[model samples]
Target: MSAVIRLLLRRLGISVIVLIGVSMLIFAIARVIPGDPARIALGPNAKAEQIASLRAQMHLDESLPVQYGHFLADLSRGDLGISLYTNRPVTKDIAQFLPATLELVFCAGIIMIMLGLPLGILAARYRGRWPDHLIRVLSLVTVSAPGFVWAVILMLLFAFYLPLFPIAGRLNDSFDIARVTGFLTIDTLLAGDFAAFTDALHHLVLPAIALSLSGIGQAARLTRANMVETYNKPYIEMAQAYGFFPSRIARIYAFKPSLIPSLTIIGLDFAAMLGNAFLVEAVFAWPGLSRYGVAVILRKDLNAIMGTVLIIAITFLIVNIIVDLLIAFLNPRIRHSARGSA
Candidate 1:
């Protein structure tokens, strides 16, 4: 077995364990909550008989063990049960809104990587200089602020005052592209609508930037610290002694090693955006899973909440697994050791 194969198997085992643990925890939390899903679904005015019927329908009247067994059975068949609030299949509700959240998260990640890595490199290359101090201060300030704060500030300045980007939503109402993918950028391009594509990018820009701000700061700070430490390593000193070009050494040698640590932090931030998207999406009126989560939670919609939490947990696990793989690839020790017979 190759090292890559071994690493992949190990990651798969970890992922399964995580999934089981998360499912159990979320299932327990959803069940133990005080509110009755049946009542919430039927509404405040529902009659006693109506509530009893709904409880039976939802299996809330079943023994706890039986209910859990039913849930697991449904899960095995890819059903997440019905939403108490919407009276729709939980899977269908997630299908409707999940793509938007994924799109937002994806755009935010791109913005973070594009801005963070380069800024970190620049800061490290000019350590102790005015530029380094400036980036450090800027990163600290931005990293300390939550994504919602940045979203509101951007809305007020760029949306209300300056009127640069549209205040909210995914795309302009005038564009006539089909919503096959639910991603306006892709849908517009597929329809050969360059005009609509440009409009979509314009809409995506502000929110993406807002989501990326803290991630960028985190990446830069992590990169700067790692690169600065790498800069003092004996290998770096030897490279300098060998008359290697400063720029070349920094870009090639130091950059790769520093990036390994940065990758971990970046992946964590990217995963966190799924949860953080709530306020940002709400403020922008972007219909995404996070908004759905908030609404479902407030309504005490058990099935909906379970579906949302499970999806988010799965996404987080996937992200961490990818990060682990990347780290293993970049770190020679792990890659080499993974293949050894045990």
Candidate 2:
């Protein structure tokens, strides 16, 4: 098999193992935690027969292994059980809120790549100069504060004081667009409603920037550090001796070699941003999975909590796998080494 195929299979195998382990751990924790889930979900007035039936459906009478098997079975069918907090299926609730969270994260990731990386490259290109110093200082300031703090600051400056953007919610309530895929941005565009799309994007700007600021700082710093090191390599010296344009060397030679390490961290940052979205979402009054997750945890909604945690865990694994594949594609050494091992 080709190295790429082998690498993909290897990552897939590892991700499966990790996901199974996470499921087992989360399943065990959800079960052992203090309250009777079925009773809680059903309510105090629920009949004894109802509670028994619910427990049976959850495989509560079975052994731990059997219960786990049933959990996996239900998961395979996207059945996460009824959520006590929402009085809806956990799966259904996630479907409603998850897209908003994903859209926010996706925009943040774009900001990280488009803004952060180029700033890092610029800083490295003009090391010891004013631009480098300015960018470095800005990055430190950005990273010093958490996402929620940034969210509040952004809301104050852009939404309240300056009144440049909306302070809360995904869109102006006036635009009555149907939820085709639950993503307002795409749904509006699909409906060919430019006004709603513009409004949705405007509302998204502050939250996405708030969430991405820290990631951007990290990406910038890591890229600068990596590229600075890359600059010292003999290859870079050779490129300089050849009288290659500074921009060309920075773009082609230094950046690509340094990107592998930076990409790994970016993947981690992107995954972590999802968890970090809780406070930012709260600050923005954004309706997303993070908000739902907090609600579920506060109520000690067992199935909802497990379902949310499991979904986040799965997202992490998937992002990591994609990053690994990207890294393997970028660095031939990895693919060759994997092929050799195989």
lDDT of each: 0.87, 0.91
Look at candidate 1 and tell me the lDDT of residue 51.
92
Instruction: Write the residue-wise lDDT of candidate 2 on 1-342 in tens digits.
Output: 277888788888988898888888888887787888778778899999999998887778789898887777888897987888998999999899999998998899899889999999999999999999999999999999999999999999999999999999999999999889999999999999999999999999999999999989999999999999999999999999999999999998999999999999999999999988888999999999988999887777877888898888888988898998899889979868745444
Instruction: Give the Cα-based TM-score of candidate 1 against the true structure.
Output: 0.95
Any idea what lDDT model 2 has?
0.91
Query: Which parts of model 2 have CA positions greater than 4 angstroms off?
Result: 44-53, 335-342
**lDDT of candidate 1 over 63-132, digit per residue (tens):** 8778878888999999998887777999999988998888898999988888888889889989999989
In model 1, the worst 10-residue window by lDDT is 333-342
Superposed by TM-score, candidate 2 places the C-alpha of residue 157 at a distance from the truth, in angstroms, of 1.4
- In the order shown, the candidates' Cα RMSDs to the true structure are 2.0, 2.4
